[model samples]
Target: MSVHIAAQIKRVGRTLTANRAFLECITGVWLLTAATHHYIMAPASVLSQVATDLHITSGVAVWLVSAVPASWAVTNFALGVWIDRLGDYRMIALGVGTVILTGVWSWWAARQGVFSSLLGSRLVAGVAVGVIWTASVNLIGGAVSDINRATAIGVFITSAPAGFALGQLSTPVIASWIGWPASFLVMSGAAGLAFALITDSVRHLAIDPTTNTASMRANFTAVLQHRAVWYGCAMAFAAYSYYLFMNSWMPTYLGQRFALSAALSGGLAAVFPAMGVLSRVGSGLISDRLLGQRRVPVLQAAFLISLPLIVLIAWTRWLALIVTALIVAGFVIQLTFGVVYSYVREVVEADITGTALAFLTTAGISGAFSAPVITGALIEWTGAYLPAFTYAAVLTAIGLLLSWVAPESPHSMN
Candidate 1:
């Protein structure tokens, strides 16, 4: 009966696949990719164990988490342009297959206790993230209908925070049983599953090589010159910087600042991403359905609401208060990705979506990638959470300012 019900669902889903299946499949894969991406972040979640296992300083150990996003930022930018040229199958296969290989390499490096090798493997994994992310964005923007596009992107963008929360929520339990290397082996399997779902679905569309040189350069310049791209990238930088700090180091901060145990800190830290799952979706719905496609107000409101919460989360001593502030902060802070994504589609020419997304990815990730290492340095220098949280509040304000500079596209003129 259960199998019969499963078959029935599959049949019904196939019928719906005409409009819904591709979006839904890639969205699920996006979520899973996020889970795998954040799993590497889990080493920071248990900083002590990693330091002990590798016999490294706390500073060096943090790089295990930092390296992935940094590499992912660069790789995402390069592949964003290439996705326009090389087509989806190559990127997806390169992406999905790259992670599977690199996961094993990461596991091997971990077992061998080779720090250099581990960093190299992590770089490979980050490339997979960049390729998959670029391809997925290009796919959704170019393929999906305009009417459902915002709604689809809203749900799709939730994958990042949802995956991070799942990784934080599950890693401690799984790591306790299997050790960290074996835990990553599990992540590899998850990546493989997501790959299976999307591999056959590539549209096989790509730019002609004869048009590549001048066209790519022209597209690059055009996307860079656009005011919407500037505002989008700038705001993304601020929003993602705060998010990267939360996803990568929130547990570490909680554990140190409050002297909480790993499991306990991980549990509490898990609250941050839970709010992100709601934020992007809610902002997307409000943009599409309620606001009639104006995205700036939603973004500005997020920054405004988040500003107080950032200060509140930082200044508070009470655990409950800190957690509550984080929940609110998480919700508002995450509105940028989906809202801005939909907004970007409106402002740019249809053909260069990949390069436009690349600019946003590169710029946003530049901010996100820097946060971990910079926050680490701040903590090293100040020896407290106050500086770090204060830094975050300042970042939120910058986002608020950028929102004002960013012109509103209540309606897509394109």
Candidate 2:
């Protein structure tokens, strides 16, 4: 571990200190992405309250939870070229700006008890999120050198789990004091701060304002034809499926099985995503240092380790034991999340990173959007959680197989 840490420090060199522009670009992009996640998840904790207040069935209210990702899945693909044309900084601004706008709109809609208005706001926010997600990564990939890119991106991706955990833990607590609407307001305020950070920092970054239709067409064709990109997409789909499965259902599962309070179940489930804060960066450090920047091996190991852990999470009845499994599974399952982002970019040329990542983001978030819905449907049909979990385990097994056979990034494999 000490040797790995030293290697990381040596690779990073003066990037952290002497390169002030890179530091600011990464910091702003990280905060911008984190704020988008916070906006995406702010309502998750209060969905029950939303259902009760709006006089809607729990079934209809669940859309409030899934709506953002569902919309994100579709728009992420549609916005691929637009992301390139607008350049990273403009796209980032547009995305963060939209989140701020929609956050306020959702808050107002909730205050008025209009379910459609609130849901509409979320769908719009999802579009913005898709924009931020792709552009932020493009900015990171473009800003850092290939040698240090994985480490930098790993650090950037930590914002996701951090923001997710923050929204899950903070929203309910904030609602308890004032009201659920206040949660959206707080999220919007956070976005406002992110906007300030980004606007102040990213002025020095390069802008790729490619407006030629022919160039866009060629880039799209190049990304679509790459075989390794598809493997990376497959890994993304599986990882995201497992991620959302746990995020969406674990709290309710704990509540149903153990009779834990909503707060307690949520707090426990929060442990799952919370683990990503450390594991994402750790995976990056290990891949960059210990594995000589090899991403496929880390991905293969994560999926292989996750197979039994998923089964253990599904069947275990002991609270203490399940919590232990959750901790380990959380870290193990998400080991690929940060790595895949780096993998997809490294597999392709620098010019088309945005287009390549669009395919990856689309596939990944599609899994995220579909997982809970599919699992919920299975549980409804079978009258049990076992089948749903089995489905997730099968997906992870497929991911492991894909990682086993997938080609490694030529540049990254020393």
User: Using TM-score as the measure, which candidate wins?
Assistant: 2
Using all chains and alpha carbons, the TM-scores for the candidates as numbered come to 0.86, 0.91
lDDT of 1 by residue, 219-265 (tens): 78867777888898888888988887876678877898789997789
Candidate 1 stretches greater than 4 Å from native: 1-17, 202-216, 247-262, 410-414
Residues 36-135 of candidate 2: C-alpha lDDT, one tens digit per residue = 7776777776778878999998789878878888888987866767766667778777887788889899989999999999999999998988888888
Instruction: State the weakest 10-residue window (summed lDDT) of model 1.
Output: 203-212
TM-score: model 1 vs. ground truth: 0.86
Error of 1 at 120 (Å): 0.6
lDDT of 2 at 306: 88
